[model samples]
Target: MIDFYFSKDQGVKVTTVNWRIHKLAQEGVITRISRGEFTLGSGISYSPSLSNKQISLYRKLKTEFPFLSICIWDTSIINEFMLHQPGRFYNLVEVEKEGMESLFYFLKGKNMSVYLDPSPELIRRYLSDEKDPWIVKLLITESPTQEVNGINTVTLEKILVDIFCDELLFDAQQGSEMDRIFKEAFEKYAISESKMLRYASRRRKKQELEIYLNDISKYRQQPNFIANK
Candidate 1:
């Protein structure tokens, strides 16, 4: 049956096979131990069932959406780790979205650790610290606003305000770090004072607008005088 469904050169209706396999698993005829890419059951272990083509597609999607975050779903088991370690896996609980079903499917097979919902305070602390701009960008862009298991998306203005507020408490080194991140974000995201103010006005925080206006002037006037070789 497995060979009939999964033969490399054969044409088989994947949906039909998937449904049949799922039903059998649920009925105790087989055990499902992983995501769509792999499965294991009594007296059988499927080794690397996903095709090389599918693996290539997955990598393409991940590369294209580098800012895509798994934390936005309020999954209690989700945790962020250093990007250097590809071997690590983390389970994210409380994910209800259909899109996340794929992520959960992959993580379950890897047997990774899970972390609970991160507090707003912790997120705020990270924003202030300027330690991880990629993370900050992901949080602002991907967090859902209002829905079951939704993550709250921060406005662009709010992001600026948060960074500014954090910088007030920073020392020299921290200030340099903030400068580096802000410059990078500004260049990468094409951020401008006008764009920031537009978001700030919607939130009814004119004070924030005033601060940004001041900062923008200072940022613009800094001599771009690069020494020529």
Candidate 2:
């Protein structure tokens, strides 16, 4: 007999181990991908970085939204800011959802954007909040009409609004982070006060709109700021 579960001081006969592996293979949980090499079946894939539970959740989400494009933000940022855990989560962005199923699917799991770059705990907390499901759904589905450096990014103004919205829904720390991002985006991207105002107007977030407008107004003396608008 060989130990199957070491902590339990339990051992399984070779026949038992073979039977279990065979049953799992039959059920498509495991497969022989190549000669002498075993692999997870169609329902599974190997991700040395993710835990079994995380992999299962990822597969389920992928199965539910086959058409959605998936991206993972830098794990270090997520660990430092969002989860505070040294790992990553799938950030699913869908551009073709026409119903509630997509939203429901995302809501069932913790989702974040490359922009949020929050810690895992924060991501989980945000997902669990009853008032934020629609907000998160909108964030996932919303796409920029353009891409920057080969990665899709929301417009600077829209990003600002997202941060402000997060602030409104959560706490000051999130809001400050959004403010920092807004400032950084303005410096790096071709953002204009008019464009920012337009985006804010479309969202009907008047207060945040006014705040951005004021920020731009104060910076009008700067040449880059003038050139941008």
Candidate 3:
């Protein structure tokens, strides 16, 4: 719209107009949704509350292995979008494959309840019995993540994709509950379809996830960004 108006009205050079657009976004006059999608308003980015336990875990792992790529978050973050809150919750610690085993054992040496990519059977038998256990998995490259108080953790895009991709881990959040979660997330946050689909592709569920998203389309309403535009 800026490009169209400026070219028709002022005949301004495209480069100068592009710079103005960048500055607008930097000054919070507009929000960038994806590569070329802009929305009006200050973006409502997701920033989960991190507990002292989560902070200590990241700090300890970083101190031990300074080069490891780690992302940590408590499952309770989902309660923000859920209508029926579950009583039990756990922590997810995703690390790069090379450091996964080493990190698991490091935490286990201190008697931390941890699991490394457990199966459905393992979930039903073991993880079900423990409260607040940490489930460590191999963090895929290019997965959407963010930093909270200097500790890495999953983004809203990754959380939505993971809920669809991992049935065993997110069983409590499945079925109609899952539908509600997706609807609430899209309504409340500035999610990038590009980032989500890229992560879904990494998990090999891009096509199936696309279908599910369409099924919930009727429940979603595009925000009225013109209020701030």
Cα error, residue 74 of model 2, in Å, equals 8.9
lDDT of 3 by residue, 26-54 (tens): 99877776556676566578888889988
- TM-score, prediction 1: 0.28
Q: Give the TM-score of candidate 2.
A: 0.40
State each model's CA lDDT, in order. 0.37, 0.42, 0.83
Off by over 4 Å in 2: 1-97, 103-136, 139-144, 148-153, 168-179, 206-208, 226-229
Tell me which residue pairs clash in candidate 1: 77-115, 144-151
Q: Which tens-of-lDDT digit does each residue in 128-197 have in candidate 1? A: 4433221111223322222221332233234444445433322221344445544434333323344444
Off by over 4 Å in 3: 1-30, 224-229
Superior candidate under lDDT, 1 versus 2: 2
TM for every model, in the order presented, reads 0.28, 0.40, 0.84
What lDDT is reached at residue 211 by model 2?
68
Against the true structure, whose TM-score is highest?
A: 3
